[model samples]
Every structure is written in C-alpha cells, then in structure tokens.
Target: MSTNTENTNAATKRVSPTGLDLDKLTDWLAAEHPGMVAGELSATLITGGKSNLTYELTDGTNAWIVRRPPLGTIMATAHDMRREYTMADALRGTDVPVAKMYAYCGDKDVLGADFYIMERIDGVPYRYADELRALGEERTRGLSTELVGTLAKLHSVDPAQVGLGDFGRPEGFLGRQVKRWKQQLDTSKTRELPGVEELHAKLLATVPAKSAAGIVHGDFRLDNVLMGPDDLPAAVIDWEMATLGDPLLDLALMLTYQRRAKIVAGYETTDPANYDVTLAPGYLSTEEIMALYEAESGRKLEGFGFHLGLACFKLAGISEGVRYRHINRQTVGEGFEDSGSTVPLLIELGLESLKEHK
Candidate 1:
C-alpha cells in the first residue's frame, strides 16, 4: 500500500487501548519513510480479532492497518508478521484480493513486538447473520458464492509463481498438522476433555493422503474476508496461520467455521451474542460450497469426510485453548466466558464427522 508522505508537523498523537506507541511509530515512519507522516498518528484497536491485535491507524489524511502479536505469551511459530506480510505482498497482483502491504517492521524495540502496515480497505467483515440479513438474501447469497469462488481462486495459484514454494513443507502436511495440533492441545490443556483425545487419535489414524499442495489459509471463513459494497470480496485478511498445505484443508476449515457459527447461534447462554451468517437465506450450504469449489478448481474432493473430521478436531483444540486462557484470566476480549462450553460439543461433532467417513 502506498502511503502519502506529506509530512505535516502537527502535534496530535493518541495511543490505542491495545498499547501501540503512536509517538514512537510516527518517529520511525518519519525517519524510515520521510514525508509519509501527514500528521501525528491516531490509532484505534479493531475488535473481533481473536488472534493477533489489529489496529486502524490514521495520520489525519491517510489511513492504514497495523497488525501485531497479541499481548502476553504466544507460540513462536503461530503469529509471524513477516510470514503474513510475505503472503500479502506476494499475492498483490493475484486474483485473490489482499490489502496492499506498505511496510514490515521486525524491530521489537519499536512496539515490543513485530508489526506491519497495509492499506485500509473499506468493507464489512459480515461476522453475524443479522449483518448479512440487513443486506437481503440475494446479496448475501451472491457474497457467499463469491467467497467460495475466492477460495477456489486462491487454491488455483501456483505457490512457486508467488515465490512461496518453500513457504511450507507440503510433503506430509496432514501428518504434521495432526501432530502439531495435538502438541498444542497438550500444552494448553487446563483440564481433561472427554472426547478430544479420542478424536485426535481418530484423526491421526485416518490422515488422508495429501493431495496437490497450495497456499492454505489455515482458517478460512466469511468473517476472515471483507465484503465490498457490491457483494464481492474487498480483501482477505488474517494470514498469520497461512502456509502451504493441502488445499482441501482450507475448504474443510471453512465448513468447520460454518458448523461453529450454527452451534454458537443456537446457544442461549453465549455472551456477546452469536449468530450464523451462513444460515441466512441465499448463502450456500456447506455441500454447495464444496461443490462450487470442486467445479471451480476442477479437482476431485475425495476423502472430504476425513478433512472435515480433522477440521473439527483442529477447531476443538483451539476452543480448548481459549477456554484454558479464559479460566486462567488470560484472555483479552469479551465472549470468552462461554468458551469452555464449546469444547465438548466440538469434540463430539469431530468424532461424529470421523464416523461418517469411517
């Protein structure tokens, strides 16, 4: 993303609640990229991000986005700002819509963590059913169709062409995922989860043969993308978990999110409210989405049952981690109070998904 470097010496500066140092950031920008600072910086933390902290930064005239690791302990491999920046930068002219990346700062001394800036695109993230409902069923369905099509487009990209051929080891990707998540679950285990171990075992035993490899978003869902005014995707954000892997894994994760949305919408005790946008009229069903991906990518989505089962297992582990942090009071935002309630149900669903395949 290109920045307008007008360089005004205005003295207005404000720090966000997420602890971004505006003065330091402005100074660094002024030194590294002269005239980029139109005025003093003002930042506001963007809520709804569950992993890395996202902030909207504006220098009175120009707007940009800043992403940094979350506060407190983080798994070293999980939130790599450089990796995210590389992916967005590589996909700059590609059909997959991504915000224009401006700069990446690895200097931890600046913000106590690495961060990057990108263009601030205008669009709604469509996190809830009510949001899409306001847009009417036709627009919502069209948006969802675009969403699946976007995934197909991403999977169609050759990693080597984007200079990301070495981004991840696609050989044995599924096995590594199962092992990695199992270790994550072990590390984050606060209490015994009844079905999680069994589910993990099933996933390990039924690891599908890896298909053609491509860039996987790791967590692909409607909320992860920005929907434009015309019902097309303005940009896809949140690439911290992105890597090269089986493309079907991305599709499976999308389906998993659909299931989680439906589950969250039905729970009365969920705090901060939850609603399933995919349940809205016009949105494609999970089966339809898979079919669309198949048609668009021209690939057989065989053994999808295994992929879905693995996706559920992965999500359950993530929920358990949230619950662990919530119980320990380590979580940052709202809606985590009921995170523990999601684990058992996710595990059960995971087991059922595996059973369908078996």
Candidate 2:
C-alpha cells in the first residue's frame, strides 16, 4: 500500500491527531500548571505550519498554543520544542516581540513527544494577498515596513545579552549551512530534478565568508509573523529553525520569499486573482527593502549576491521537503495540493539566482 493509505488507516485507530493526546495532556497540565485550566481541555489543529505541528488549546476561559514534532520519523535536530521555548523566553525583555512561554515538557510519555505551551497573541498571520488587499495599499505598505524593521531589530540584539550565547556555534556557519541543506535535499528527493544538483554544486563552490554572528531566523517570512491591528508586528512566531549565524542569511531568505511570492503570483500572467501579499501595491520593492535594512541596522551588506543565491538553494530544499511530505499524505491542512509543483520552479530559480550573482 502507499504511505498515504497506511497513514490514513493508522489515523483511524488514534483518538486525536498524530502527535496530540488531549486527555492525557489535560491531566498533565492540571498537575503541573494548576489553575491554568478552568475547564476540560480541548484542542484544534492550527494549519499553515509546514514543519512542526501546532494546536490551539482551550479551556473555555483561556487559549494557548501547543507546538510539537510532526508524526512519523523526523530529523532529530529539526523540530526541537526546547530550542523554540528557550529563544522565546530569552527574548522576553528584548525589543523582539515573542509569545509568552509558559511551559516545556520533554517527557514523550506526556503526549508521545516533547511539547511547549505559550500564550496565544491576538493577531493575524497574513498568508495571502487577499487578506492584505482588504487593508488597501497604505496599510499593506506600513505592515511590510514593520515586518522588515522587526527583522532588523531582531538581528541587532546581542545573543550574549539575551542569554543565548551558547545557543549555536557561529563559526563556519555558512559552510555548514551549505552541506546541511544539501543533505536535506537529498533526503527529500523523490525524482530527478533538472538543475537542482547543479545549483547545489554552485552554492558549495561559492559559499561566502561568514559575517558577524547574530540570531538568524532560518525561515524568515511574512506568514511566519503575527501582525497587530496597528500594522506592526505583534509577535514573531515559529522559531524552530532559529539559531546564531550570519544575520545576512536571514535577510536573504526574506528576500527569497518575496521573490517566490511574485513567482507564485504569476508575474508573467494577467491573473489578478493569483497575486500574493508581497505583490500588493505599496509593498516595498527589493531595492527599498535592502536600503531599509541597511539604514535601520547600520550594517553594510557586503557579498549579498552570494547570500541571495544560497537563500534560493535553501528555500528550494525546504519546498522539496514539503512536497515530499504532501505526496506521502504526511502534510496537515489545505493548500498543500500545489506544493509539489513549486519544487522544480524553485530549483530553476535557484540556478537563475546564482547566474545573476556571477
């Protein structure tokens, strides 16, 4: 039988979704964080996450977010709840807005995997252009500005000052990142992808010298952040891929997403309905974004072309992994139907990005 069929059959025997054990979780929380729950605990899966599983928990009087690893086999270092919790807790008093962390449970017996809980911030994670279009150009521009500014603010903080000095090794970060993503790509590959191996080889050959180390959000993008009513970033969620590394990598990844948004929106086509949020009127152009970051952080971005090329490679690997999961029926929620189609396009974009760099 296909993996999807096996997974579907397996799910039928389970009480809750893959990684959640609602009743046991409720009991554990009551014992550990008494009075935190006022009634019976219930959970609803929160979609839009492509890595770790996120669930919205409620006790009728309160709401919380629970994050844990996805079901089935996973990379050991990837979906670490402790890492996410530590970073969020460390950034509490800093300028970076993060959800308030409540607890982290490493015992797998509690819910079949490690998990963490945090107070849910009230804001919207704007995923598409339709949401931003309703807000109009002015508000969308303001929101985009806040998004970029928030990232700069995050990179400005000293990791040592935030008690995350030992979080990750920054030395040789760029080289390791190249190898790491290449391995991820190999593991996720289901078929031969033209230009993907060539792009990987090019990225390895052109790894740039490491810049000063700072906290890098490995998957920085619009949908990853929660925007408040004032068009400002309320909280930067999804820190699972965060670590200390070259801050320029973070900037490049954000730009890559911006470029991908355009690609997904069909820049060559006149399909108005295909527009992405990044294509919304008044959103900052690529040049404007670079300038804004430079001005805000007072950091001259040297060797940025190399970083952008590598960003494309990294994102291509990520997209391929998502596509693999979707094909296996291991993905949660809607919108995954077209995920596999983006893989080849992203690989092609990665090659094109490197050519431009040369």
Q: For residues 148-230, could you state the per-residue lDDT of candidate 1 as single tens digits?
A: 99999999999999899889988898888888778778878888889777888888888866566889988888988998888
Q: Which regions of candidate 1 deviate over 4 angstroms?
A: 1-14, 264-273
lDDT of each: 0.81, 0.82
| Best of the candidates, lDDT | 2
Location of the lowest summed lDDT over 10 successive residues in candidate 1: 1-10
Encode model 2's per-residue lDDT on 203-277: one tens digit a residue: 888876556789998888788899887778889999998899999889888988888778766645646655667
Evaluate model 2: give its lDDT.
0.82
> Which residue window of length 10 is worst by lDDT in model 2?
1-10
Task: Tell me each candidate's RMSD, in Å, in order.
Answer: 4.6, 3.8
